[model samples]
Every structure is written in C-alpha cells, then in structure tokens.
Target chain A: MKSLKALNNPLSTGQKQLDLLHKGTSETYKPPLFVDTIEPTGHFPMKAKGVEVLQINMGKMCNQVCKHCHVDAGPDRQEIMTRATLELCLNVLKNESITTVDLTGGAPEMNPEFRWFVTEASALGKHIIVRCNLTILLANKKYNDLPQFFKQHKVEVVSSLPHFSARRTDAQRGEGVFEKSIKALQMLNAVGYGSGDLLLNLVYNPSGAFLPPAQASLERDFKKKLKDQYGIEFGQLFAITNMPISRYLDYLVASGQYEDYMTQLVDAYNPMAVEHVMCRTTLSVGWDGQLYDCDFNQMLEINCSGTKNKHIADFDLEALENRNILLDQHCYGCTAGAGSSCGGEVV
Target chain B: MSKSYYEPSDLGKFGDIKDFQPELAEKFFGYYNSVFQEGALSEREKSLIALAVAHAVQCPYCIDAYTSTSLEKGSDEEEMMEAIHVAAAIKGGAALVHGVQMMNKAKDMSM
Candidate 1:
C-alpha cells in the first residue's frame, strides 16, 4: 500500500473510485437486485451504509485530469450543481431521513456553493462527507484553508492517493501531485483531522485495469508507509475497483486491455456483493440534479428508474426506495471481490 | 485461431485441462488452488517466489501470470525486479560452480 494510489473516480470525488470490462455483455441484469428492493433493516453499520448518504456531484471541474478519470473532469469543464439544485438537495435532507451528505465532484471545492451546501447540511444535523482530491487544497491560495474549514464542519474527508510512490502517482494523476498531496495530508493532520472523531480517510483504487487488494491490510500498509515516510496519519483506506468509464474506458480500449479487464471483472463477479452495492442504499445525484442508482450510472446518464422521482426537486425517499436500481457492465466494478462503494468494501 | 505453440490467451484457460481429464485435473487443480492460499509465506511473497521460479524454469506463461499477480498484490517494480535478479543470480552461480569440475578435469588430464 506504500503507493496504492487509488483512482477514486468522480470515481467518488463523488466515488473517491471503478473499472471497465471492455468485451462481453453476457449477464444482463434483472434490474440488479439492490438491497433497497429488499426490505433494508437499516442494520448495516458500514459507513455510507443504510438508506441514507445523499451523494451530490457538486461539479465537473477539477484541477487534475487523471488517467482513469470516470468523470472526465478537467479545468475546461464548466458544469456544476447550482445553488438552486443544492437547495433542493438540502430540502431532501431536511424533510427526508437521509443521514449523510456526501459531496463529490471533479473537485467539489471548485463549486461556488460547495461550502454553503456543507454548512447547510451540517446545520441539519446530517453527517457530511467530502471526496477531496488532496492536491486541490494546494491548487490555490484561496483553497489552502480547506482543512480548517473541513474541520469546522466536521466533514469526513475522503481523498484519493492512487499510490504512495511519486513517480507512479504522477503518472496517473499529474506532475507534483504526490508532493502536494503529502503536504495537504500533513496540513489535514495538523488540524487534528485524522485524529479523534475528526475523520480523514484515504482512497486507494488501482491505477491500471486491476482490482484492489484487501482493504484492512492495505490500510495497514498505508498507515505504516505514510507514518514512516512522512509522519502522516489517516483513519482508513477505501480500496475501490476502477470502473471502465470515461477516460478509464478510453484507456482500456486504446491499450487493448479492455477485453482482458472485462474478463477479469466477469470472472471475479461476486454475487454476494450484489445485494449491498452502493446503489441499493446510496442515491447518486448528478450536478444538474438528476438522480441515478450510483455514480457510475450518473456518469452514463442512467437516471433513477422504476419511479418518476428522477430529480432533486422530485425527491421521494419512499418512491426511490421502491424503485428498481439500474445495472450495466460498469456495475461489475462495484461487485467484484469485497465490493467497492463510496465507503469502500461493501461486504 | 491460435497460430503459435504458446498462445498467451491459453493462460486464461488454465482450467481447461479439466475438459480432457475431469477426475485427475480436478484433484490437481484443487491442490494447486490450495497451494496459493494465504499460508506461512503470504500470497504476495508466494507470487514473487513464483515469478523467480518462472524465470528459473523459463516458463513464459508462468512469468506472465506471476508478473501480473505480483503487481496486483502490491509488489512495486523494484521489488519484482529484485526477485528476478535473485533467480538470475542462482542460475549464474550454478553454472560458475560447475567450473570447479572443469578445473578438476583439466588438472587430472594434464600437468
């Protein structure tokens, strides 16, 4: 885990990660049996668990254009959730029983209303999670104070590191990202973020077309490496599978790894992971306020199904719970092995 | 469609040996799978060892398989290259050690 550098796709900056299967579309899903379809006992204690975690993609603008970016996010992209849409999301959290407000994006901080949404959601007594891309904190002097702001709101910060080595991390994310990320992480630690209840977590998705190793052990490696090398400390590690979408999918096809990667996903598909996939509990809201089963679907423009409540304005916890979750090839990125979600390791 | 004696895709079908001999292949594969599980030497370590052995045996298929395995298991490039070097050192040492026999034969034959 010294250099695990997870892709954590829009791959949760709404995902914090996903992978692609290039060739076969053999096992068509019967609306992929999401746990919401079944009676959720609300017993699962995993983070981002339960019928909550209102994940909103704040924008598609980012400081870095990662190689496996599922969002295809970059500086040129101007799309972002407006304050109006964020108000609708806040309204849903206000009335409905949603417990977590997960903010992600090309870089959620880049959104004009990002801090406003977090403050409003925090005021609502809902737990907040920010899928930070560590280097963004150092992207500009204006954003430099992000760690303190995050601490003030008690936001759970989940940033993708991809790998611990500078060369490899730079290869995937951008030049000098690893150094800046380290500085950002140290700043977060200085603010007492990764200690006590002020949570700070790291995301590790495979840089290439491969599944992540075990999470718990990987977390241990990350802890040792960061602590040893940089005296940095964090809470946990989320090992997300890289979803084949956007830039990642494009990489797969160009490199001719798509077919083999897809075969790996198909072979490693764990039915046990299907029931607890993030879409079952977590509702994905795009920048424009459209709803989908998960972030992957949001990227593919597969809106909320089996119900008409497909936008933040038409928010309906009951209807959404009863709706059939959409499924496709990219979903295998979530179900393979222990399962990948915003929280990481679903099973 | 295969045009070579060693098709890389065949590695994906290592299980296909079962199609020809179900009983024996099943037994061998059962043991093979068990052999690679988390044992005294972690799976990552085993993968590196497999890589070294693959080089020693010069098995293209195993080299390809274990290289990918080692990478996914969190072995960095340096670590993997070091493993290969270990195999190379042994192979080189084995040949040099045989030079002692040559020395003995030369001494016995003349002078």
Candidate 2:
C-alpha cells in the first residue's frame, strides 16, 4: 500500500531487495510454493516436422534490458554470432528452400553482418524478418539509418511495443524507453514501415501478469488506440504470450508473483492452439549456430536429435524436417488461446 | 545492488501511506480488481495469467493465490506443470545470460 512512487523508485532491483528483506522479517513463516523447484511432468516433445521458417539468433546483444525479456538481451551481452557462423547460415540459405529467413537478436541490427544476411536473403526472394526492439533504432548513431535500410530490403520488421502508454511501456522496459520507442515508431512510420503497405508488424505483450487479450480483438483495439491516442499507424498488432523466463522470472520472484502467473498460463491452456504452434513450421537457430525446434526451445538450449545437423552449417533440410519438437511448459504459451508467435497469433 | 527497495520498516507505512491518498489507493485497487475480474478473461484465464505472472514477477503471494485458483478453475495437474516449465526456461535463459556479463567483466578486469 506504499505510494506508487515508493513502489516505482527502487525499480525491479529494489523490488528484489524488498522481497529478501520481507523474507528475513518473517522467520517463523513457512516459505511460499517453490515454483522454480517444481519439476515438469512431461519432457519437451522434439518431433520437428519441417523447417519452413529459418530463425537466426543474430546475438544476445541488445539495447534495452526489459523486465520480461526472455532472451536476457542487453548491450552488455556479447554472445554474438561471428562472421564465420554468418557464412555458415548463409550457405544453408543457399541450398535450402526456406521461405522465411527470420533474423533475431539482442537486436538483429546490432550484428555487423545483419545487412549482409538480410540483403542475401532478400536477393533469394526469401521473406526476411527482423525481431527489432524498436528503441534500438534510436539507441545509437550507427543504428539511426536502420529505418532506411529496412525499407530498402522490404524486411518484415517485427518490433516489440509493450504498450501504447509511456508509463506501462517504461515500467516493463527501462525509464525513458517508452519515449525512445515512440520516436522509433514514428521514424518507422515516416519510412512508411508501419503505414499503409510497408509491412511493419508491432508486437504487444501484456504489461502485467496475464495472457494477452484475444489477438483479433486486441489488434483492433491497439490499432484504434495507437492511432487515436498517438497518431500511430501499423499494419498488425501481434499480441505475443510472454513466455515466463529470465529477467521476467526474476521479476516474478522478486515481486512474489511467480506462482500466480504460472497457474494463469496453465489454467488457460487451449489444445486447439497446438497444431499452429510456430515450432511446427519454423526452426530456430541460436547465436552459436546451433539448431532448436523453435525459438522458445532455443532460448532453453533444447537442441534437436543427434542424427540431425545441430548447427546451421549442417543445415540438412531433410534431416531437420520431420524431426520431433521439444515441448515444455513454455510451449503452452505458443498453444494458449489463439496461440502466439513472432508473426502474431499462430492459429 | 541492493536486493530490495523496501525495508521491513516500510511495511508499517503500507496502509498508512495509502491512508493519505485514499483515492489513488482506491484507483489501484480498482484496477487490480478489474484485472482479475472475469470479463473478457475467464476465471481460468485469470488464474493462469496470475500463475504465469507469479513466475514473471516472482511474487510468492500472487503465486500461491493463483495456484489454488487455477486448480479450482478446473486446470489439470499437467497443465500447471507445463506452465512451471515455461517459467524455468525463461529463468534459466536469463541467468545463463549473465555469463556474458561475467565474460565482459573478466575481459575488462584482465585488461
């Protein structure tokens, strides 16, 4: 019940400290459920059918250190793919019929070879996607020209805009991030990215502990709200189910919110969403050139079987195609409600 | 960095702090209530989100409340188990990421 200012002052780091102090104050009190220690009943299902979507984790390096980022991406992270790995990925792109070459990262633009990959992929008529953390466009001078670069390539840019409001967005990201994001969005808009036909997709994960509202409904609401409130225009609003991980998990723990959120995801499990899970069609490749069933599994380091090519150099389309997918609790996020993926609702 | 922003002494100010600004407290409480209400979201949906959020924010009270709530809302044991796994993946990935910071620090320190 402390003032909202008091709650906001310390930031997430402060919240974590408060949790520790609170725990120590109540010596006789029994600890709450050990949500992290709870073992999952089923293992990750690893039956990968085919790699239609080629996702490349350009690196772990990013501009913003947001609260719910599953990748734990930040400027401090240096786990970037080397030029050698880039060549390997590009080599696979050459022989493979990958319709979509998804380039992701701390910020895909952070990678020195990002343009190289995008240019090559586009030349091959491959649909290229950059999982942009919009603020990155404004993070540095070198990146300021990204809007123009993206326009030239016609890359389908999927940017994360956690909320329309500055406060909510900044609460998840860092202070002033919402302002930068707005500026970046406006920049993209100027380039006709989020305008009528430029194909700029904005992603919106719930700011609080909840599954996103229905995709169609939420998108409609977002389009209207963003346009009316901020004069923002975008093609689609992708409501991604925040896969509980990393800093977000730490936030849940620090704020004593872990168990409730998990229960929420579990209770909202929708079986109809399973068939359209993005992993069914797309294959996620990590920074080190390793392969994963999907992006979530890649984040978890769950690799495909030994028979298949583990890295991009070993991009055996026949081998990776029809492999078993590895599913854990996070997979439910992709299968919950209308389902969620980098490209918006799966089903 | 300090692990928490609030001290045990701060809890004493909880109700009293809100007492001064009754309207703001009411607003937050109202927003919180509406968030949990079964409007577009079902009771089951609320519980599931509370559970996922419990993991995301790492709140014990929220976690405890939603766990039971999810079960009561007819969530099966397996579904609950999977949600935890999602939490684990995210948590684990985040922690492993610190290795990059460590590596950076080590390189800088060495220099």
Candidate 3:
C-alpha cells in the first residue's frame, strides 16, 4: 500500500492541525479534555522526569506501508537524516549521562547511515535498541545480514508481529508480512536471540479498533504458538496500543469509527498508566534533527515546550527535563487501560 | 423510545443499575468481577467459557461484552469460534435429546 504522503492523502501533510476531539455538550458525554482529565489525578501540566532514552528516527523511507503507521513512512519518503545530524547525536551521547540510544525509522535499516550510526553508538558504550520491522531483513540480499549485525552490537531487536495468525497479521500490516516476519524471527533465533541475554522482543498492537489483550497472557500465547508451530523463540511480547494519528487516524475517520474509538480510549483512561508514560524518560529526534516529546508528538509536530528551537544540535537536557509534556486527545492512547509505551504496558 | 431494544450505548450504563438498587448491584458486580479472575482455570479459559455462555443465552449485550473480553484475554478467532460451537452443540443437543421421551410416549400410545 502507498503511504498517505505518497497518495497525497489529506491526513498526511495536514496532520500538523490534527483535531484532538475535545468537543461535547455539558448535558452529554463529551470525553473530558486530556489535560483537564489528569488534573484531579495530580498530573496537571505533565512534566518530564528525565531523559534516559534517545530515540532517533533514521528516516521515513521504509519498504512497506503498514496501515497503522504513525510515521506515514514508505519508500516514497526522501527525508533521510544527514550524517551531520547523526554525528551530532553521537556527540550528545558522548557528553550526556543518557544510557540508551534507540534507532527507529521507516525501517531504521533503510537509512544509509543506519549501520554507521549503530557502530558509532555502540562504541560509546550506550545501550542500543533498533525498532526493526522484520520484513526489512528479508527485503533485499544486502539487508539479509542485519540479524548477525544486531547480535554483534548487543542491540535489543524489537519488531512488530501484530498477530501470530497470518490472516490477522497480514490484514493489518500487509499481505505476506506474517510469513516473512516468521522467517526473520527464526533467523534471529538461529543467532541465539531470545536465549540468555540476547534479548529479542516482538511487539503486538490490535489488528482493529479494540485495545490489545493483557500483556502477560498474550506473551504466553505468542511464545507457545511461535515455538510450537514455527520453532521461533522471542523474549517478550510488547502489547502497544495504537495511537490515533497519521495513517491510523485516517483509518479511524474513513471507517466511521472515529467517535466510538475515541470514546473507548477516553473511557478506559488509567491515571496509574500516566505515571510511567515513555515520554517521561524518552526524547524523540525526528529525521530532520528536530526534537519531540515522544514519537507520537514528533509525528504531530508537537515539539518540546520549554525551548523555542529544540533541535538535536542544541541538546539542552536541563531545559527538556523540566518542560511540560505537550498533551492532546491522542495522549489517551498512551494512558488507556494498561497503558502503552515503547516497552509495552506501563502499568 | 429509540425503538431498538438493545442500544449499543446501554452497555456503558451497566453501572447505572446501581442507581435502582445499589446494594444488590454492588454485590452482584463484586461477584461478577471476581468470577472472571485467574483461579482454578486461567483467565483465558474463563473468558472462553464466558463467551460460550454468552452465546448460549443469546444476550446481545453479553455477546458484545464477552466477545471483546475474550479477545482482550488473548482468545483468538479460532478459539472464540470454537467456544461458540460448544454453545451451539449443547443448545442443539438439548432439543434433540428430548426425542427419546417422545419415542417412549409414542410406544405407550401404540394399539
């Protein structure tokens, strides 16, 4: 499928003014404004506790266009990060006390400077995480050796496998994705992933409008099915709630499910989940070297609030740590039910 | 008077039953919530059973609630459909098994 950007879809470039759905009458059930909803719970003007994870978007050039992608990333995108930006990121890591550097992208591997950044970041003694879409490892012969490369760098390999069933997974991601994902997972296991401390994790988001299942039970099911059927082993299954933004927001609006889906998100809000939101510890660097509160904020052009020009070159940790996390209706996605983050359910 | 007996929105008002009879509703909900927790049977197992029971009674609200609950508890399409089949078989069997009584009564009426 072509990306929203490639198709010239309204939701693609127009997301800067995306609606947060804070509307309704006093007599009716309007989901309360996300910021207001948190006030009673003592999270008014949510602030970042610290920055421990540096999530860098290598670029928006991915091989496949999954339906729920927030990045609107696909092969048509030309926004690869330049070597200068990556060098600046490395310099920041060298100076800051930040511990982990997470590499993500259309597919981070698709970035020309991807390997160079990984090698450089690994050299800094920084824990590295690569948000690999498993199919990329099998997309081309040149990309086939990524598993071995990741294993060497001690990079935590996190890939999305929406469902263990091919029909369900492919329905959401794309045709033949489940087959290729299984093949790639087996490849990772062959290199000792999911064994000892190699740390291979799979991510699951619901195929449709519903929230993801309980993380522990779903992980058990994923482990048993992958092991018993395809002889694949994965360490953890991160159940991330799909945020209503970009391609996913487009899906909700087009399917006539916008109100129902938003209602579900609002009604299921959990205050405990807010306390562990990924944004508190993570800073997202966009492909163009700009900084965002989180990846979702980056997608929506919601930059860090404390500074005027919050770019990676600036690298103001103290300012960013104190900045109020910019909130929107989309944030309900992160705090819904068990809560969602890069590492899965926060609560 | 919205004409339809089952309003999808009514499911959200399931808690409003407390406004009518708070003590009884509270006790029932306490029991209902605890019944679904992981115990002798895993929560997944209980969800499948609940899904089957929802189908057996043919309650629209229950069918909707349990269908989503079953999925949330990690029950897949195949397992969920299988649970429905269990409900179907028992319901069908309840009618067919009564044939033996009819057969005996017919014999009693034999000339």
Candidate 4:
C-alpha cells in the first residue's frame, strides 16, 4: 500500500482529489452519528431484501478524474480486474437468478478486457448496465467507437452529467470535459442508444455538498436543454445525492463544510426511503472480486457484513441473502430525500 | 426571562411554540408541514425560498433552521449564499425606495 503522503504529494489534479478524500477520512472531524438517526426511526440494522442487480467495479483506470468521484479512480491507479476475477463474476451471474449486471469503474471501458466481459455478460441473457463516463469515448482514438459497441451489446449506458451547462459540468469534471461529453452523447444518440429500446440514462450528482433537486423535474430540464441546445437525447435522468465518502468527503473537510453536510444528511433522513435502497436489491463487486453491500462501502473498504461469502468466487446465495447490509455515516446519502441508488431515486 | 432580548438557545426550542398556545401552534405547525411538501415547488426549492425569507425577515431562528434546511434539500453553499443576496437586495431596495417619500416630503415643505 502506498503511504498517504506519497500518494497525495506532487498534487496533480487527480492526486489533489485523492488527497482531499484522504483528508476527509482523518480523525479530526466527527461524522454525525448515523446509526442513532436510523435506529430511532426503527430502521436499524438494515438488511437486504434480495439481489437483483450485481454491480461490478471493473477497474480504477479512468481518463478524467472528477473532483467528486467516489471511486478515487484515475489514470495512475492500475487496479484493473483480472480475467480470473471476471470469470468468477460471470460464473456467479450465470448460476444466480440475478437480472441485471451493472458495470462501473474509474471508467469500466478502460479495462483491456472490458469489451470481452461485456460480450460474455450479454451472452448470459442478462440486462447489462454500464456506468460510463461519457468523456472516455472521446479520450482516445481506440475508444471513439464505444458508442456503437454499446449499442451492439444492447448495454444500458448510464453516464454522469453533473449539470446541463458546460461551465458547471466542466467545473466539477475538468476543462473542456463538457465539450467532449457533449460529443460523446451525440455519438451515442447517432447510434440510437438513447432512442426507443436502447437505454441511455444520464446521472446527475450535485457539484457541491448538496442534495440533487427532484429527479422528475431535473430530467425534464435535462431533456429540454440537451435537445434544444445540443440536439441530444436520453432516456432518463437520475438525480443522485453525493455520498459523503472518498473525493466528496475530502471536499467537505477542505471547505470546512463536513460537519454541516453530515448534519444536513442526518436532518433529511427519510425512513420511507430505507426499504427501497439499492443495497436491499443489489450487490457490489469490487475490482478484486470482493463483495460489498454497495459501491460506497467498497470505496470505504467495508466488506459485506458477514464473515462468509465475502468474495465473489466464494459467492453463496443463501449466506448473502441473510447478510445484514452494513450501515455507516455514509448511508445517510442514500436514505436522504426521495432516496438515491444506481437506478436513481428509489422512492 | 434573561436580560437579553433574544436568547440563542430559544432557536432550538422552536417546537415549544405549542406550549404557549396548543390549538394555534398545532394549526401553524400543520400548515408549515404542508407548505414544505413536494408540489408546485420541490422541497429543495422551498428550502431555498425559506432561506431567502429567513434573511429578509431577519429571524435568527429561521435563518439557522432554513440554512440547514436548504443544505438538507441539496442547495449548495453558492446557491444558499445567492439566495441570501436576493433577500438582501429586496430588503435594501425596500428601504431605499422609501427614500422617495422622504424626498417628496422635503420638496413640499421647502415650497
């Protein structure tokens, strides 16, 4: 493991983002008591309902390192999933009754065998969902044809567009990212990816330490703006609340807003949102094939609640079905407002 | 009960309004709840509006409540501060506009 100082020093764009996330995890600031808030609402020890979506973190190699990325993924980080791990994930998907296979990463498409894995997963007659950073498609010549490839595989592409405007989008991502992303979306649109059956979902996470506006309203705004301004189209807009972990955590602490943000999340805790949380119906697989309740937990290095069935290779459906969904201060992000998930607002 | 006109701690006791007049407080709290729900404006939009109103009214209790409420509803610091400025502008403009009346009165008296 690299030391914190070594990984964070020289403060490149990605490194600065990494350093912020690291600084957030320091012991100086106390996270609002997460369990106390939930327990009082009789939603303590949140448990999984069943596994419907198997979300896999393909790798931590991404082109653009967004400031609020929870994965802490970047170009320098070389933690790609091996063929062996991919095989194990496939094996589980093959045998289990899982309906959706959601792929995520620094950019899942960055993995060398990303296409191969998608091909195999698609062959399994499963609903494949890829969490793509649209800028990746325009990052290099080799990746330029990714939109067509996604269309070929019938993969549901869920890309993050922080805001509709370039100024705000580029501010959170990087300079010129908005332009590249717009081009990529146009490419996807050209291939009918956002049309009738080919699902193209856009995700909206707040640029700062705030919850997103209502998903339906934001979706309408995104649809109208993208159509009129850029002649772009998409299926749905998922309004996601930024989880207080990783890069975002670093941001809150650096700006002296960590405590306030946590308090806000705690205050907005909606008991009704607990039952429909993605963790209840989804399982997250890390790059190394370790199983977690959700992606945020995987980032925090929190494994599944139980001692057994911790790895995807040793996946036991029964053990996992009974496993308690791990809870932490970060869980507040998911339960707040209408609730947040990979599928967007749960409630 | 204390010497100061405003007690900082009273902000936390906002719910204690019921203790003074149960019927009116109940009705007021009920209306407040209905006002904040998602409808024509989202809970988030309402929070921002509330934060602006809090500043305009110069209510310390409402300022603290709505500031947190605005953040809870997912309004960023930039947006929150902007909302405050909107309030400040309106409040300042209201006071400034009243100067026209003073000017008119001075002209009449001088004549």
User: What is the per-residue lDDT of model 2 for residues A91-178, given as tens digits with 9 covering 90 to 100?
Assistant: 7777555788888878889888888878888888887888888888887899999999989988888888877667767878889988
lDDT of 3 by residue, B28-101 (tens): 99999999887877788898998999999998998998888887676779889999999999999998999999
| Every model's TM-score | 0.85, 0.67, 0.93, 0.79
Query: Which candidate gets the maximum lDDT versus the true structure?
Result: 3
Greater-lDDT candidate between 1 and 2: 1
Which runs in model 2 stand beyond 4 Å of their true positions? A1-46, B1-111
**Best candidate according to TM-score:** 3
lDDT for A311 (candidate 3): 95
- Over 4 Å off, model 4: A1-6, A9-33, A40-44, B1-111
For candidate 3, the per-residue lDDT at B46 reads 92
lDDT of 4 by residue, A1-347 (tens): 22122267332243343344434445675545667777876667877887888999999888877888787777777889999999999898985579999999989999999999999999999999999999999888999998888888899999999887777788788889999899999999999988899999999988877777688877886898799999999999998999977677767777888766776687888888887889988899999999999998888777898878589988988788878988876788999889998878989
Each candidate's DockQ score against the native complex?
A: 0.46, 0.02, 0.57, 0.26
For DockQ, candidate 2 versus 4, the one ahead is 4
- Comparing 1 and 4 on lDDT, the stronger one: 4
Order the candidates by lDDT, highest first: 3, 4, 1, 2
Candidate 1, superposed: residue stretches over 4 Å from native: A1-50, B1-4, B19-24, B97-111
- Which residue pairs of candidate 4 clash? A20-A250, A211-B74
- Fnat of every candidate, listed in order: 0.38, 0.00, 0.50, 0.38
Can you give the lDDT of residue B104 in candidate 1? 97
Please state the CAPRI-style docking class of candidate 2: incorrect
Order of candidate numbers by DockQ, starting with the best: 3, 1, 4, 2
